[model samples]
Target: MMRANENARGRLSWKVAHRAIPFALLLLAAAALFHFSVEVGEGDTLAWDQAFLLSLRHADDVALPLGPAWITTAMVNFTSLGGVTVLLFITLTTIGLLLISRRPVEALFLCVALVGGWLSSNTLKLWAARPRPDVVTHLVAVGDASFPSGHAMVSAATYLALAIVACRFLRAPAQKAYVFVIAGSLIGTIGLSRIYLGVHYPTDVLFGWCAGSLWTFGSWLLFRRFLPSQA
Candidate 1:
C-alpha cells in the first residue's frame, strides 16, 4: 500500500512538472518582452538597432540592401503577407469556414484574438513611439512608430491562432505538426522580411514576436478554459 501511494505521488509530480514547463517558459518570455520594451523606450537599444540596420545595407549605398536585387523583391512580396488587407482576407475566410462548419464559437474566438492582438500591437507601437531607422533607406515604404513591428506581431498572432484552430480538426500528429511548422515559418519569414526591408529594427521584430505570441496563447488558454468544446 505504501509503495502504491508512492507511485501515485510520483506520477502526480511528473504531471505537474510537465505542465509547469510551459508556464515557466511563458513567464520568461513575458519578462524578456517587458525588459526589451522598457530598454527600447529609453533609447538604450538605439545603437544595437542601428548596427543591425547598417549591417543589412550596402557599404557604398545605404539605400540598397545587401544581397542580390532579386532578394529585395522577394522580401517585399513576403512582407505583404502581414499587411492589413491580406490578414483581413485570411481572417474573414477562416471565419467563414468555421461558421460553415458550425463552429461559430471558434470563429468568434479567432476574431477576438486577431483583432485584439492588432489593437494591442498598435497601442504598443504608439506608446513606444520609436522612430523608424535612418541608418538605411527602407526598401518598402513605411510610416508611424517602429518599436514593435506591426507586421511581425500581426503575422505571429494570426498564424499562431490559425494553427491552433487547424490542429483541432487535424487527426494525425504529423499533420498537426506540419501546420504548426508552416505557421512558425510564415511568422518568422514575415518578421525577417520587415527587418531586411529596413523598416523595422531587429528588437522591434523580436519584441513583437514575443508580445504577439503571449497574447495569442493567453487568449487560447482562456478559450480552452471557458469554451472547451470550441477550443
Candidate 2:
C-alpha cells in the first residue's frame, strides 16, 4: 500500500508539472517582447522607427499619407478606438455585462484594472517626457509627452482586460476568440494610426503595446492565483 501511494504521488506531481508548462511559456514570451521594445524605445532614432514613420507619408506633402483622402479619414476614425471616451465606453459596457451575468466580483476587478492602467500609462508618459513626432505634420491635435502612445497603452489594457474576463467566464470558446480578435484589431489599428497621423513614432506604439500587455497579463495572473474561479 505504501508503494502504491508513492506511485500515485509521483503521477500527481507529473500532472502538475505539465499544467505549469503553458503558463511558463507565456511569461517567457511576454518578457522577450517587453525587453526588446524597451530597448527600441530608449534609442528613438533607430533605423526602423524613422524609416517606418517617414514611409507612410507622401514625399511631397508630409501632412498627407500616401493613400487617398478617404483612407486618411478612415485612419482618423480608427484612432478614436484608443481614445479616452471610447475606452471608457467599452469599460462601462463590459462592467454592465458582467454585473448582469451575476459576476459582481469580476465586474469590480475590471473597473479597478482599467482605472489603474489609465493612471499608470499617463504617469509613464510624463516620466519618459518624449516629445511627439516632428518628422511630419500631425493630423490631429495633441499636446503631451508622447514616449508611449496613450491611446495604444490605454486601449490595450482595457481591451485585454475585457478579453481575459470573457475567455474565463464565457462558456463557448468561439465567444472568447471573437472577443480577442475584436480587441486585437482595435489595439493594432490605433497604434498604427498614431504613426500614420504623425502624432507618435512607431517606437511609441511598440512600447505601449509591450507595457500594456505586460500589465494586463501580470494583473490577471495575480487575480487568478487569489481567486481562480472569479478571475
Candidate 3:
C-alpha cells in the first residue's frame, strides 16, 4: 500500500510538471516575438486610439461630476494610482504570498512573469514610438513612447497573477469563478480608463492586454506544476 501511494504521488507530480512545460515554452516564444516586433516597425496604431481617448478626457459631462474630481483623475496619474504604482503593489503582494506560502519556486515564477511582462511592454513602446494624441489636449503630460499601453500590460499581469494565487487558496468552483471575474474586470477597467483618459491608444491597450494575458496564463501553468497537490 505504501509503495502504491508513492507511485501515485510521483505520477501526479510528473503530470503537473508536464503541463507546465508548455507555458514555459510559450513565455519564451512571446519574448522572442516581442523582440522581433521591437526590431520591426509594424505595430504603430496608437494615433487614432489616443485621439479618441483624448476626446473623452476633455468631456465635461461624460460622467457625473462630483464637485470637481472624478475617478479618472486617479487613472490619469501614472505615479499615483496608475500603472507604475499598481505594478509595484502587485510585485509586493506576490512577494508576500511567496513568504507566507514558503514556496520560493512559485514566488520566483511570479517575479519572472511580472518583470518579463514589463520589459516586453516597454520594448514595444520604444520600438513603435507612436506619438500621443495632439488633437485633444492630454489630461496629463507624458513623454515616454506610447505604442503599447503600459497601464494595460501591467494591469493584466498583476490582476491575472492575483487571480492565480487566489485559485490556489479557494477550493470551491464558484469562489474560483468569482475571483477570476473580479480579476478580469479590474484589468479591463484599467485598460479602458487609459483610453478614456486620452493617454493610451486603443491598439496600444489591446496589444498590451494580449501580451500581458499570454504571459500571466503561461506563468500560471508553469507554477501549477510545481505546487504539491494541496497547494
Candidate 4:
C-alpha cells in the first residue's frame, strides 16, 4: 500500500507539471495581449469592430432574419436564462459528481476554479473599463465596463471547466477530443451570441475568450499542485 501510494503521488506530480507548463505560457501570452489592447488598440480599431457588430445587431431588414433570430435567441438564453445561473449549476454539478465519485479534493478544486475565474473576470472588466458597443440599442441592460465581455468570459470558463472535468474520466483520445470540441462549440456560440446581440464588440469577445481560457488553465494548474490525493 505504501508503494502504491508513492507511485500515485509520483504520477500526480508529473501530471500536474505537464498540465501546468503550457498554461503558464498561455497566461503570459494573454497578459501581453491584454496590455497591447489597452495601450495600442483601444481607439480606432476597437471602434470599427464595435460599429460593425452594431450594424449587424440593428439590421432588421437584412432579409435573413433567421440566422440573426436564432443567434439572438441564443444570446438571450445565454444572457438571461442560462448565463451565470447555468455556471452556478455546473459548478454545483461538478461538486456533486466529485462527491459521488469519491473525489472530494477534485470537487473542492473545481469550486475554487469556478469562483476564482469569476473574480478574475470581474477584476479585469473593472480594470479595462471599456464601454459597450453603441450599435442598435442594447437588447439587454448591462452596466459593467466592457473590453473583456463578462458573458464570453464566464461562458468560456464554465464550458472549458466542464470539458476538463469530463476529460478526467475519459481515456480514449477521441473521447477527450469530442469533449473539447463540444466545449469549444458552446464557448464559441456564446461569444458569437454576444456580438450578434450587440452587447459586445468582436474584440471584446475575443479578449474575454482569451482571458477566460488562460484563467481556466491556470486555475487547473494551481489546483493540481495543491489538491490532496486521499480520494
Compare the candidates by TM-score and give the number of the best one. Answer: 1
Q: What is the descending TM-score order? A: 1, 2, 4, 3
Would you estimate the TM-scores of all the predictions? 0.87, 0.83, 0.72, 0.79
Supply candidate 2's per-residue lDDT for 9. 99
The lDDT values for all models are: 0.88, 0.80, 0.70, 0.73
Clashing residue pairs in candidate 1 (N, C-alpha, C atoms within 3 angstroms): none
How does model 2 fare in lDDT?
0.80
Q: Who wins the lDDT comparison?
A: 1
Give lDDT for model 4.
0.73
Q: Model 2 reaches what TM-score against the true structure?
A: 0.83
Runs off by more than 4 Å, candidate 4? 1-24, 55-68, 80-82, 226-231
For 1-231, candidate 4 gives per-residue lDDT tens digits of 999999999999999898768877986887797676675244757667855764673356432323546766667775652277778887897799789988776787677666776787788777777777764566677787777787788777777877877777778989999999988988888887777666778888887788777778777776766654422
Give me the runs in candidate 1 sitting further than 4 Å from their true place: 1-28, 226-231
What does each candidate score in C-alpha RMSD? 3.0, 3.0, 6.1, 5.8
By TM-score, the better pick of 1 and 4 is 1
Cα lDDT tens digits, model 1, 15-127, are 98986787788888888888879988898988988998899888889998888999999999999999978998999999999999988767987898789889999999888
